[model samples]
Target: MTRRLVATGLVVGLLIVLLIRTGIEQANLNRFDRDMGVILTAMKDEIIRAEGGGVALDSFVTQLPGWQQQLETIPPPTNSGYRANLLQSVLQFTVEYGKMADTQPDQARTAEMVENLTQAIAGWDEQLRNGPGEAGHSH
Candidate 1:
């Protein structure tokens, strides 16, 4: 009877530990989702304002390293394909905006960049829906 009690206690303890770990992981994923949403909204707003020269694409680029650093600080599963997609979108926006600001200097290019960014975001969303891990993860 004592042996059975010990085994049951051990099983219960292990189950509790697993539950706690899962909860923490879920919380981290939630935080990642919230942060990504905020960043995407800001990007969309900037693209919209680019038509009036109100958006500073260079400024956005300059801030990206800091954002990337923040992402790196998050624990694993937080830096998944969604984060990669955000980085790609930001890079694409910067390059396209720079080109438009230089040669075209018009709303057409700004619109194109916005569409590209949107498509990139959508692609990333699809990837996440199809897989739970990072797209580049080898394991």
Candidate 2:
């Protein structure tokens, strides 16, 4: 009887620990989703507004550093595939942006930036399709 009681207590304790761990993970995922949403929305808005104007493009370029800083704050993914995809998207966009900056300065640069932005957005869409959970944790 004593052995059975001890076994039951051990099982109950492990169950409680599992439940607590799951809850904490869920909370972290929620926070990650919120942060990613905020950053992505801001980036989309800026890109849309910068589609034509030189001033807008300049402003958008100026904002890139801040966006990068925010992105860096995102926690490492629990899943390797998701993390790799996210990193790939970020790197591809950065390279495309650099290409735009190196090209001749004009509305042409703005157009290139817009095109690269579109590609980057598509990369993000692909990431969403390949993301880990039903809840779509972004960070």
Candidate 3:
């Protein structure tokens, strides 16, 4: 009887440990989702500011460094290869924008940039909802 009791207790203990670990993982993922939403919104706002004019563009430029910092704070989960790429794209965008903003890329080019950014954001959102799969890139 004592042996049976000990086995039961061990099983229960293991189940509890598993449950706690799963809960922790889920909480981290939820936190990641919420944080990513905030970052994406900020990215959109930057593009909108660029769409506005010089003052808004200046504001956008000022905000981007903060955005980059915020992004770096949240390292992508090891399970998320696609997410890592999306984050890289965002960082690259900020760097590219800094270069382009200096020379002031033409309005048409600016619009194209915004469009591509929008597509990338949408693609990542889809990936998060569904599952990670191939999203082709170019040279």
Candidate 4:
């Protein structure tokens, strides 16, 4: 029957579309994971390097806006989970560091800022390894 054939074709088409969408989403997630790993590790390294007294808060103040924009582009699921929280902390630290850089440009407060961001970055890295364990993971 033509009706039966049409129904099956519709179902097959829908399934293919679903598969394509899922594949695209998976690719996006993979890229996001890789980018975040690099970003977090770099941030932590900069923080750790602050001990040697060469980590310039002014450079961070300029650099963080781009990082913040990248963080904003991360999709949901993990975005709403611990990853989002950690990103918020990073953004907050960026703003605070910028403000602090305006006044004293000292190492003590910069080190403290780095410590806070280091903790957030560590938590984010752990969350990434664990995968998106939250409720809104799309198939």
Among these predictions, the greatest TM-score belongs to 2
Q: Provide the TM-score for each candidate, comma-separated.
A: 0.57, 0.73, 0.71, 0.66
For residue 134, model 4's alpha carbon misses the true position, in angstroms, by 8.3
TM-score of 2: 0.73
TM accuracy, model 4 = 0.66
Candidate 4, residue 1: how far the Cα is off, in Å? 2.3
Residue pairs in candidate 1 whose N, alpha carbon or C atoms collide under 3 angstroms: none
lDDT at 17 for candidate 3?
100
Among these predictions, the greatest lDDT belongs to 3
For residue 80, give model 3's deviation from the true position in Å: 3.9
Model 4 alpha-carbon drift over 4 Å, by segment: 53-66, 69-89, 107-113, 132-139
lDDT of each: 0.56, 0.66, 0.68, 0.64
Predicted candidate 4 versus true structure: per-residue lDDT over 1-139, tens digit per residue: 9999999999999999999988886777677667777777776666666545544544555566777777676654352355455556556765665666666666434566667656766766777767545634332
1-139 per-residue lDDT for model 3 (tens digits): 9999999999999999999988887777767667777887776676666665556556666676787788788767554566666667667776776677667745424556667656776666666555465555310
The runs of at least 3 residues in candidate 2 whose Cα sits more than 4 Å from the true structure, single-residue gaps closed, are 91-108, 122-139
Candidate 2 on 1-139: residue-level lDDT in tens?
9999999999999999999988887776667656666766676777778777677777777776777777777784474446545655674565556455657556434576577776676556445445645546544
Candidate 1 segments whose C-alpha is farther than 4 A from its true place = 51-110, 122-139
Give the 10-residue window scoring lowest on summed lDDT in candidate 4: 75-84
Model 1: lowest-lDDT 10 consecutive positions: 130-139
Question: After superposition on all CA atoms, how large is the RMSD of candidate 2?
Answer: 4.3
> Which portions of model 3 show Cα errors greater than 4 Å?
52-55, 99-109, 129-139
